[model samples]
Structure formats: C-alpha cells, structure tokens
Target: MERWARELTARLPALAPDRYAVARPPAALAHRAGHAWEQLVLPAQAAARGARAILCPANLAPLASRRTVVVLHDVAPLREPGWYSDLYVRWQRAVLPRIAARARLVVTPSAFSRDEVVELLGVPADRVAVVPGGVDERFTPAAAAGPARAALGLTERPYVLTVASRTARKNLGVLDLAARRLAARGVDLVAAGGDRPQFRTEADTAGILTLGHVDDALLPGLYAGAAAFVLPSLYEGFGLTALEALAAGVPVVAGARGALPEVCGDAAQLVDPTDPEAVAAALERALDDPAPWRAAGPSQAAPLTWDATARAMDALLAEIVA
Candidate 1:
C-alpha cells in the first residue's frame, strides 16, 4: 500500500500537478494509532488542503467523508474470515461497508476483486473500477541470476521459486507436498517471504528452503534465477508477484484461482492449487521447456505500468471532482 501511494503520488505531478496533492497524517499520529490515525486525522488534513475529494489508496477510508475515493484491494476478510484474527475481522466488517457505502468511487486492483467487492460487500458494480498494479522496470531478464542464487545459498542447483507471506491462504501446503514429489526429480523448492512458525516447521519435512524476507534489491535477481516461478495462492487481489516473475522473463506456474490467471494470462502454466500433483506436473513442465514461457512473459507484463494506473486514477479523480 505504501509503495502504491508513493509511486502514484510521484507520477501525479507529471499527469496534473495543479489538480492533485498527496495528503498524509502527522508522523506522531501515524506512529501512535496506525489505522486509527488514517481514520481520525487524514480526512481533516485532506479537507484543509482544499481538496474536493480525498483518495485513500489503502483499503480503509475515513467513515466521516462522503466525497472520498477508496482503493479496496479485496474483500478477503469477508470471503475467508477464518484467515484473520477476530478483532481484525470485526474491524473490517464494521468499517468496509461504511467506506463502500460512502465513497464516491471505489478502485480495485483487478476485475476479480471488483466482482468480489460487488458480490461480497454489496457495493454497486458501476462504483468500482479495476486498476491493476504494475511491475517495476527493475525486474528484468537482464538482472544477474548468479548472485541471488548464491545469496540464498541455492548454489548452482535449479529450483522452483514462490514468493509469498507464509500463510494458509497462500496454499503453501500444496507447495510443500509438490516439493516432496519434486525432490525425487532433483529439483528444490525455494520460498521467499516472511516466516510463520507453523508453516516454517512444515517446510523442513519437504526439504523446502525458506528465505525469510528477501531484500528488495535481490528480488529481481531471485526471480530471474529460478527455473520457474510459482504462485499456488488460493486467493489474491492482483497476484503482483506473478506479474513480477513475468516481467523478469521467468517461466511461471501458478494456480488458476483468483486474479493469477488474469495476471499471468497465457504466459504461465496454470494448475489446480488444491492438488499437489497438478502443481508438481506444471513445475516439471515449466522447468523442462522454459523457452516458450520465457519468450512470452515479458510481453504479458509489458502493458501493466504504474504510469497507466496513475493516469486512470487521475481521470477517475477528475471525473469525481467535476
């Protein structure tokens, strides 16, 4: 969310400097209350700036404002309430409807999420706009793969890579089972993201190496280095990491679920995320013949740009203000 805010705001000056301004809560207030700060302080700050409509890039918006544009990534809490804490679910249930009801326009990262919002949150379809996220130009096939492989202690062995926060919704269990099957074929599984103690312990039994929180600089190289990049997530708002892998000219193997198929298009080998055998077979196919996917990936990711997203948002804002 911070990245989206920074990039979109940075591009706004070139798009229409006089029309838009970035509004943020005070540092002290932000540190003290976090989301509470956004709810309590941001709306007034935006109003004081002579803003006609406030654009809240992050999901939650101040309930007090009717002329606000809120970007809702997904209605995941409502769809899969089991994945979140009780308090978190309660908070989202309370605030999301209010934001959806009041906001002048609601922006989402994908059509899948827009539908989810309309169906799950009872928001009108016309009020929701799909504005997918973009992959950074830095994620290119030109990045040296060797350094990243060595940094992650992967040596020269070929590995299937998946980048995700360790969570049940990410469907790491399927990856774990797939890894066990792939081990016999001499292919290792490398997972890059934060560690969840529960999921981390399970990876060892399958011989999957977990690199907790890869540095931003190394991520492009990591994507470039993989034999194939996989995302077996059960649900995703936009599947940005799959887009990143496509941008890196890597062969992708992802689940057909959520926004992954839309993001990956024909560039990836789509599989049933719930079935380990299907994921394993897809990984094997990708690793065996990566040429076709590698050639197709960059083109798939080329049209997704932050500039385009910003322009779309700029036009939406203009319409809202007008």
Candidate 2:
C-alpha cells in the first residue's frame, strides 16, 4: 500500500500541478493514525481547500465523502474473513462495502479484483477502474548473483523464494511438501515476509527458511539471486512481487488463480496453489531450466510501468475532477 501511494501521488501532482496537492500525515503518525485521519480529518481538510476530488489510493477512505474515488485493493477482508481477527473482519465488513457504495468511483489493481469488488461488494463494474501495478527500473537481470547471494547469506545453497506474509490466504502450506521435496535435492525454500497483529494465524515453517520482512532495497537482489521465485498465494490483487521477480530475470511459479495468470502472462509457470504436488513439480522445472522464463520475463514486465499506472490514474482524475 505504501509503494502504491508513493508511486501514485509522486506522479499525480506532476500530472495536475495546478489542481493536485499532496497532504501527508506526520511521518510519525502515518500508519498509527490512519483510521481517525481518513474518516474525520481527510475530508474536512479537502472541503476546506475546496478540492474537486480526492483520490484515496490505499483502500480505506472517508465514507461520507461523496467526492472520494477510493481504491479497493481486492476486497480481501470480505472474501477471506478467516484470515483476520474478529475485530478486524467485523470492522472491514462494516466499512468496506459502505465506502465502496458511497464513493464516486472505485479503483482496483486488476480486472480480477474489479470483478471481485462487483460480485462481493455489489460495486458496479463500470465504477471500478483497472490500473495494474508496476515494477521498479532497478529490478533487472543481474550480471553476477554472487554479491547479492553473499549479502543475504544465501551463498551456501540454491533456494526457491516466496515473498509472502505468514497469512492463510498466502497459502504458505503449499510449500510444506515442496520445501521437503526441494530440500532433498539440496535446495531450500526461503520465505521473506511477516505476519500482522490483526492476523489470527500461525503457519508451519518447517523445511522453509523464514526471513521476516526483508529490506526493500534488498528485494531486487533477493529476486535476482533465487533459483526460482514462487507465489503460491491463493489470491492476489496485482501479483506485484511475481512481476518484480520476472523483472529481475528469475523464473516464477505462481498460482493459476486470481490475477496472477494475467499479471504473469506467459513468463511464469502457473499452477494450482491448493495442489502441493503440482506446484512443487512446476517449481522443480523452473529451477532446473530457468532460461526460457528469464528470456520472457523482462518483456512481459516492461510494459507494466509505474508511469503507465500513473498515466491511467491521471486519465481517471481528469474524468472525476473535470
């Protein structure tokens, strides 16, 4: 969400300097003060400035603000209530639908998420716009993976990677059998994300090396050094991590469900996240012969740029604020 906001608002103001201005919460209060600021302070400030429209890019928005164009990044809490705590899910169930219905227009990251919004939240399809997320320019095929490998202490063994949090919908269990299978081949399954307090869950990380919350600067190197990147997520709004892996010239094994197939295109090997055996087999193939996937990845990722996403957002802004 921070990435999307930073990339978006960075480009948005340039697109409409005369009309667009950014209002940031105190750096200390960013994540800590979202709800209260979003509901009460945001709309009040906008109205005071007489802003024509407000682009709430990170899902949550002021429910009463009719001029709000809220971006709903998948409607996951409504779809997967079991993944979150009772308090979190209850609040999501209450606020998300109301925000979707009340906003002037809704923005989503993919056609799959747009459909989910329409089907699950009863949002009109026409009201939701598809603005696919992008990869950073720095993520490209590395000439030498040794430095990155040594930096991450991954020089000892080749590893298959998954950049997902320890959440149920991430389908980390899909790695249970695969990790064991790969370990037998002198390979490792390395996971690089952590859990949230609102997440009422625990995953068995047996046979997998869990590196909680890898630094963002190390991500490009992490993706580049992997023998293969796996995204066994049952669902994704935009599959941004897989796209990054592709951009870094790594073979990707992603779930066939959600927006992954479309986001990955023909660059990645798609398999069922539920069927552990199939996902494992696909990962093995990708690890063994990464040449084809490596060749195909950059081209597939090249067109999905932050500039393009921002341009699309600019077009939408033109519509709403005109």
Candidate 3:
C-alpha cells in the first residue's frame, strides 16, 4: 500500500498537493474505533469530500462505506484457521465475504486468489481483476551492496536471503533446517524482518546472520547482492519479495505453493516448503548457477504500476457515480 500511495501521488500530484499527508485522529477516537482507518474522522472525511467510492486495499473494509471496491489479497485465514488469531480468523470468515458482496469490483493479486474469491464468495469471475505487483525503482542489479552490507555488518559469504514478517504460516521452521544444511555446505543465511526476533534466536545463529529491522532503503541492495533469495512460505497470495528479487536479477528459490510459482514462473527453483531438504537443495541449485536463471525472471512487470491501478479504480468509481 505504501508503494501504491507513493506511486499514485508521484504520477498525479493534484490528488495530493503536499505529496504526503499523515493525519492522526485523537487517541480517544482511535481507541473507540477498533480499527483506526475506519474511524469517524476518516469516514467523515471521505463522505464530506463527495468521494463516491472507497477503495480498501486489503480484504477487510469499513462497514460504514456505502460504495466500496476492495482488494482481497488472499483467503488464507479462511483456509488455514489455526494460522491466525481467533479474532482475526473470525473476522475474516464473517466480514470478508460481506465486503466482497458489497464491493462493486473485487481486485486480487493473482489468478489463484481470484479463483478462491470466486469459489468462496460466489462473486463473478469478471468482477475480480488480477493486478500483479512490480519491483520498485529502488530495486536493481546495480544497487550498491557495499553501503547496505557495511551498515548491516554483513561478512561476505555465499549467503541465501529470506525476507518475511515471520508469521507462523510463513514456515520459518523450514528455513531453520535449510540454514543448518547450508552452513554444513559452507554457505551462510541472512534473514530480515520487523517481528522475527524469536526466529533469529531459535534458528541457532551459529553461521546465520539476522539483521533485525534492516533499513527499508537497503532492501534492494540486499536482494541484488545475495547469492540466492529463497522464500519457504507455505502460502502466499502473491510473493512480492520473490518477484522483487527476480526483477533485481537475483536467482530465486521458492516453494511451489500458492501464488509463488505463478509470480516466479520459470525464473525460480521451486520446492515444497514443508520439506527442508528440498528447500536446501533448491538453494544450492540457485547458488550453483545463478546466471543461467536470471533471464527467467519476469520479462517485465508491465501494467502493474500504481497509476495503472488507480486509473482503473477511477474508471470503476466513475461508473458507479454516474
């Protein structure tokens, strides 16, 4: 959403004169609202400005919006009940379909997710559009690794990198085993996330390096510099990081699960995330011949720009308003 917001503003500065605006409603109001974005202040602002349609980037939307377009990223919580919080699971089960039913058009990241929405919510297939994500301009093969590695104190070695939020469903255990196997083969692993301190501690960091909360700007460099980038996630609506790594000209190793394969295409070495040995083997393959796999990366993430997204959204809104 941050990328979307930034790109949209850059393309259409009129919509956002100051380029960015950070509005903080009162703490009391936030406390009362349950969800901060759906609170009285934001909804009132939307309504008062004659905003005909509301766009909820995520599956969940403010119930108060009369006309809405929602992007349902995935239906994973519904499929894997034990993977999320009780409240989150319940809310997803109950509220997501309601939002889809109410939304004029539902957008999803991949055809896999679109199929789930169509089957689960019974929304028409035509109503859901697939908009694959793109690599940011900051991501490129030329991105400076020296600054990023120096800042993170990374010692140069054949390193496999994985970037994730460390949720249970991400299958961090697979990565733990893969790291151990890689270490035995004279390779190191580096991981980065905002909420993965427990994973860092538990991964037995003897040969692994955990750069907790790496600077966001350095992410592109990190991806470009790695020997290989791997994602052991069990499920993903769309693996944006894998696509980003591929776009940066880095060979990818990802599980043949969910939308990872769809986004990666022939650009990645696919494996079962549940099998640690498979992940390790895939990582080794990518490391052995990273150059041959570079061409398989996305030809070009065309028409995935945020301006394209917002323009499509604007057209949809115009129809509803008219």
Q: Itemize residue pairs with steric clashes in candidate 3.
A: none
- What lDDT does the true structure give each of the candidates? 0.85, 0.87, 0.72
Runs with alpha carbons beyond 4 Å of true place in candidate 3: 1-39, 196-207, 298-322
| Candidate 2 lDDT trough over 10 residues, lowest sum | 25-34
Better of 1 and 2 by lDDT: 2
Model 1 segments beyond 4 Å from truth? 26-32, 195-205
Ranking by TM-score: 2, 1, 3
Better of 1 and 3 by TM-score: 1
Worst 10 residues of 3 by lDDT: 196-205
lDDT of 3 by residue, 1-322 (tens): 4454345445434443433222334656532263655634556777776666666665666666656767787888787777776776776788787878877778887898999889888889988988655566677777888888888888887688888765676776677677887888777898877553222223333445767777788898898888888888888888888877887778888889999988887778889898978887888788777777776664544334555655655555556667
Clashing pairs in 1: none
**Candidate 1 CA-lDDT value:** 0.85
Using lDDT, give the best candidate's number: 2
True-structure RMSD for candidate 1 = 2.5
Backbone clashes, candidate 1 = 0
